[model samples]
Target: MDDDRERLTSKPETSDPLPKAEHPWVETLKTIGLSVVLALGVRSFVADSRYIPSGSMLPTLQINDRLIIDKLSYRFSDPVRGDIVVFHPPAQLERELVANGEKKFQEAFIKRVIGMPGDRVEVKGGKVYINGKVLAENYLGEPPRYQWSSTELTPDGIVPPSHYLVLGDNRNNSYDSHYWGFVPQDKVIGKAILRFWPINRAGGITPQPDYNN
Candidate 1:
């Protein structure tokens, strides 16, 4: 009976609650803080979101289409032909006109890389031929599309070293390399890799092929 009584009186073993589980508020704040940091990191380094503002890149990128730009690519290698990219305007343009009367230097524009350094690009008879070979473009939407005016390089316009010549998929509306000039390599901001908005139309964009050069 004494042994039974002693055993009953002895304290039972118990586990301390899980390492003082963090307070709900503290956990919530930590999660929020981490998310903000991650977002900023993505915006600055990995990827960023942008909206199409004009018809310049139409057929492939429509007006108001939201896209996710891949910021990690150019860090390791140079952009290639047919990769759609975003870049700043050239310096020769009038600042006031380019900024559109805005106070800040708004220089971001999106277009497809049609020519790279040392490439010979030309438009003839409504078709784009590079280095004497015709290019196959499967992205242009319909049969009634307006092809840009045929123009040939008066002189061999070598794509400047470390620069790319870009064009809008909508040949008639875009103000791209044909109108202005090549985009300096340093000015390329990123590549538009995916379209994430509008649930019904969400998918990755396949970069166009470049014929053997």
Candidate 2:
């Protein structure tokens, strides 16, 4: 009777063991890693944030204004006129920077598209002319203080294929297409869709100008 009771009470032995509880530190590290990966993925392929550091886009985008750049839309379609774009400096600008002793010159720029492929662009008498018609830009706080001839950037003033002419709303202050050259389609990072900083000014970026009218 005693032997039978002991055999029934004894625990069974097996090769398999119960899983050990994960260490709290290990769990924390895993969570952090996953968060970082997700953030990077979203920033690289989905959307990202940028802050304006200059007045190039002033009256439209103020200095230090935070913007959400849409990285996915241009994947399905080409950029159009009036889109506020952020892009890496073009080769021409990069070369100029290097010649001027700028060793690290991979800065990005933000500007509004003013001319598309094969479009004629010119700036004279404080007004921008596209295809010989004056561009009705009501967003400018003031008229451009400089002049840019059509042939200055390219022969015949036509924007080359896969290239875009971009300018700042603060045209005279911006070092842009008129100074360096056109931005290649591939250099564009994305378009600025919304401004989310400075509560009072927070809203979608300036509406796209109507070119058809």
Candidate 3:
């Protein structure tokens, strides 16, 4: 009877075991993967960084200058004149490259918006004109050395709907719309918002004061 009592009072040794702790390395890998995914998501839809690779935007963006590109703004509104923008090569340029037998690749180009839909753009006598009025440009490195007329560059003497004329601040040296053609609205990637590198010159890329006057 005492033995029976002892067996009744004792806990069973065959009870279920506690769950095993996960390996430390397994947890570490999970954290790393989550961080990578978050970074990629932000770059794709929120904002991203870019560095100037040439003097095309000189005096405004020097070679090797790093900038923050805002990819969200254009989704809410259309790009306006004087906004620095980055975009993919347009179809016209792609066809030319293909004709030259060059390697096919997508590269982003940076330039400032100069003409909007329905606007007439003309470059002559060291000045840019929009709709017959001379543009007030205080940021150009120097006057454009080349001449361009809307009638000569486009099918009509005005910017087509959903197209933008882009040019480099370093007008004389840039390979821009005057050389190739208009940038389709859909090809634009984003507006350049800030310069973050070369700390002495770091600041917002402010839009030029309204030149429509």
> TM-scores for all candidates?
0.76, 0.88, 0.86
lDDT score at residue 130, model 3, on the 0-100 scale: 93
Off by over 4 Å in 3: 1-20, 99-101, 104-106
**Model 2: pairs clashing at backbone N, Cα or C within 3 Å:** none
Candidate 1 lDDT score at position 79 = 93
Alpha-carbon lDDT, every model: 0.77, 0.90, 0.90
Candidate 1 lDDT over residue span 116-177, tens digit each:
78877777666676777777777765321433321333256667689887888887766777
Stretches off by above 4 angstroms in model 2 are 1-18, 211-213
- For residue 167, model 2's alpha carbon misses the true position, in angstroms, by 0.3
Q: Could you tell me how far off, in angstroms, the CA of residue 15 lies in candidate 3 after the best superposition?
A: 11
Question: Residues 81-118, candidate 3, lDDT per residue (tens digit)?
Answer: 99999999998888777777878554899999999999
Candidate 2 worst ten-residue window by lDDT: 204-213
Scored by TM-score, the top model is 2
Residue 125 CA error for candidate 1 (Å)?
Answer: 1.0
